[model samples]
Target: MSRSIDINKRTELKRLLLTLDVKAIPLWGKMTPRQMVEHLVDQVQWTNGKKTATCDRPAEEAERARQLMIYTDRDIPRNIFLEDLPDEYLYPDMETAINQLMTELDDFDEYFKKPGRIAIHGGFGPMNYDEWLIWHGKHFGHHLMQFALM
Candidate 1:
């Protein structure tokens, strides 16, 4: 299992993002480098209350489901597809996308310093700030490996 995204992990994530070049190709996934960054940005925005997801279950049940998904050592199953993204495309270039994602990461980190409920994750249900950090950290690591950064 991955470490949760605290200040140190957030720094590590930013460093990993910096390692990607504009032309970097995924070793496994369908998204380009820029698109991957965009997807990450969307995730951070969701965590920071800038976006929302409709819950498919009641809050308690959803959180229970999330606990089941996250408490193990297994990698999150591969090739999971997301539906109903907010934009057709978000950033036009890798540099732009990376910059936006960095800003969102900063925002997410700041949000974590306070104790509060985070935005609902589409599949994971309601989350507190710490839970968001764990989920995002795991998700980020998964994508980094998809691009062979891990």
Candidate 2:
């Protein structure tokens, strides 16, 4: 599946996010617009090493999943539930959640500017910056599509 928006394009991302509001309903999945944005914020924090997570899968399996997810053009499947994440929205409003997501994205970019920086993904073991970028692109693209914004 091809991405409808490139997550690396911060300007475009902010523009698209501006169109999303509290009343917006997801085309698929249970998340409200606010919840989804907050989810993205959490993900960006984790990817940037601002938050930590232990690998849930065996090392070998995590590596294989990481390889497939990062190297392939396939889109993340719809309706995949993450039990570790909160079901309720963290922020009081959509605007705040979106702003936090953007801020986290900026931190993610800055954190990865140094060479050899690595972060631990909950299901992907250890990943370098480029791998995390691919994961975030796919992940953010997935949710954007879920809200029919991409």
Best by lDDT: 2
* lDDT digits (tens) for residues 1-150 of candidate 1: 653344346567777778987687777757877778788888789876677777887777877778876665456667777654444567767767877888887887777677665677777777777666667777887888878887
Indicate the worst ten consecutive residues by lDDT in candidate 1: 1-10
Q: Pick the candidate with the highest TM-score.
A: 2
lDDT of 2 by residue, 21-61 (tens): 77888888888777788888988898776898789899999
Clash number for candidate 2: 0
Separately for all candidates shown, the number of backbone clashes (residues 3 or more apart, or on different chains) is 0, 0
List the candidates' TM-scores in order. 0.81, 0.91
